[model samples]
Target: MKLLIIAPEQIPVPPRAGGSVENVIHQITSRLPEGHRVTIVSLRRGYLPRKSVSGPVTNLRVPGGSKKRYLANALRRVKGLAFDLIQIDNRPGFAAAVRNAFPHTPIAVFMHSMTFASPPMTTRRKANADFRHADLIVGNSLSLQRSLMSRFPAHRSKIAYVHLGVDTAQFRPSGKRRRGGYRFLFAGRMIPRKGVPTLLRAFKIARKSVPSIRLSVAGGTGKAAYRAFLRRTARRLNVPVRFKGNLPRKRMPAFYRSGDCFVCPSQEHEAFGLVNVEAMASGLPVIASRNGGIPEIVKDGRNGFLVTRYGKPAAFAARMAELARSPELHRRLSEQARSDAERYFGWQLTAAKLMELYAERLKTASAGRRTK
Candidate 1:
């Protein structure tokens, strides 16, 4: 089968600069079965060429500017090619444009979240039309799928989920024992909704008992005000929280390795926590909020601890302190964390699931043609 995959315009493919969606697209396209040929379309960035070929896979980097211009450039570049299926990453609007170009081709809109399917991003009528127009709606999590299904019940049959993954081989553990207590690591955008302040509060509470415990945050992708707010909160709490800024994808494995335990303190519902999977793969147990699809990834007292009191700093502090205090418990959880990622969250498994869905779509389409 020949496939055309569209990465979001935000980042180029082979996403060295850093974009999870771009990373997911790169992983999927690179891991397609030998029989399949794939072409990945992404925004032209850095020194990368407009087009480059590597065996069965082709990469097309289109120009960036406005979202409208990006889509136009991408669609224009692929006008001559015919594909068995076209998958658009995270943008429902792109499906319509591609549909206009290849009206008969089966189009899959791979939504990472309900961002595009809801208002403020796009109008409700537009969202509904976009959902109806796509041949398949692929979500990254069951929670996201459920939300989409409820929002567009009429089109529920087309919506499905295939969990995103990490390259366990690359994200493998350092195999080093924790020698200097637990260092809680947070690696996401520095935003209000991410609950960084709650983490700060929690860290302070934990540090009160475990004097040698540490917290290192590895994200700077937010407004200056928000970053300042986090600094002020940390100063007021009088805890020395290390802000490592945003590291590129290549450096992330090392970033994960640097910490003893990983913390994801999201106040809002996450569609899926890829960072948690990354941390788990790196053999660091996760301590994330028990909301959204997090519960699906993190099993309480299994891979890591889940804070049921998601907003309350005291609850998060209790779990952090418990893990810091108990080396035996952390050891058990760490081993299981890596094992779970290898078994369930590997990119190979993720690619295979997506391929299965695509193959099924082609099989049904072929059968329909035969009947016609």
Candidate 2:
């Protein structure tokens, strides 16, 4: 079957960025059946074209067309193209534009994140309406699925849940090694919603008790003032937290390997905990919040301990301190974390499941056409 994939912008086919959406796209394309023609319509030039990461397929770069020129580009290709299905990776008006381009083709949308709900109420309604147009909708996590269903109940039957998978092969269990100090790692954007402040406070409390502890934060400071506030808070609280600002993706595995444990203290708005998954894959126990899709990934006390949503510096600190002291608990959780990641979050499993969903959607679309 010929497939047309519409994306907001060019994403590397096994994406070097290590983002969940990019991983999903890479996995799906790689696992598609043989003899299937897959033409990727990416908006920008960051990704290379004609590179085969997966199967025998052709990836076409769209060269970043404007809304004004969308119809022109689509019209030019629509005449000669024999696309059996159209699949979109994001919203942001890209899917709507593709729908306009190929009105009759069956289009399935992959909702990587809840972009509509994240925005203000005024714009959210409009975004929700646009999403309702897709024939099939895929959510990366159950939390995301619930959020989407709450807004648009009519399409609940059409929605499917396909959790994001990690590269377990790259991130696997290597027996616990003693690192320099009781190292604590946090990797993600240094933003408010990520609950960096909560992690900071907990680290501060932990450091007061465990004097030899060290905290390393990696990721771009998304909000400048928030970044400053965190630094100031660390100074005032007397916490030894080192901000390793924005390390490259290639360096992440080494960073995770070096750290003793990983913490993702997001207050809320975390649809799925990709950072935690990476840490788990790297054979480290996670100290994550019990909110959003975090609980889905982490089995509290089994794989890792899940702290309450709100900040309790003493409690959070105590947990960290305990982990520091009890190498056995750390080792157990680390083993379990890696085991869970391998059992549930493999790219091969992700690719196979996605193909199943696509096949089911195609079958449904074919049946509907026959009935008409």
Clashes of each: 0, 1
Best by TM-score: 1
TM-score of 2: 0.89
Candidate 1 per-residue lDDT over residues 213-329, each given as its tens digit: 998998866488888888888888899888887788788899999899999999998999899999999999999999888888999999999988889999999999999999899
- Clashing residue pairs in candidate 1 are none
Give residue 74's lDDT in candidate 2 (0 to 100): 40
Quantify all predictions' global Cα lDDT against the true fold.
0.88, 0.74
Give the TM-score (vs. native) of candidate 1.
0.97
Encode model 2's per-residue lDDT on 28-113: one tens digit a residue: 67666556667765433455653333455565544445644643454455456767787777553555666776788878888777
TM-scores for all predictions: 0.97, 0.89
| Deviation of model 2 at 366, angstroms | 1.1
Candidate 2 ranges beyond 4 A from true positions: 10-20, 31-37, 46-54, 65-79, 174-176
Model 2 poorest ten-residue lDDT run: 44-53
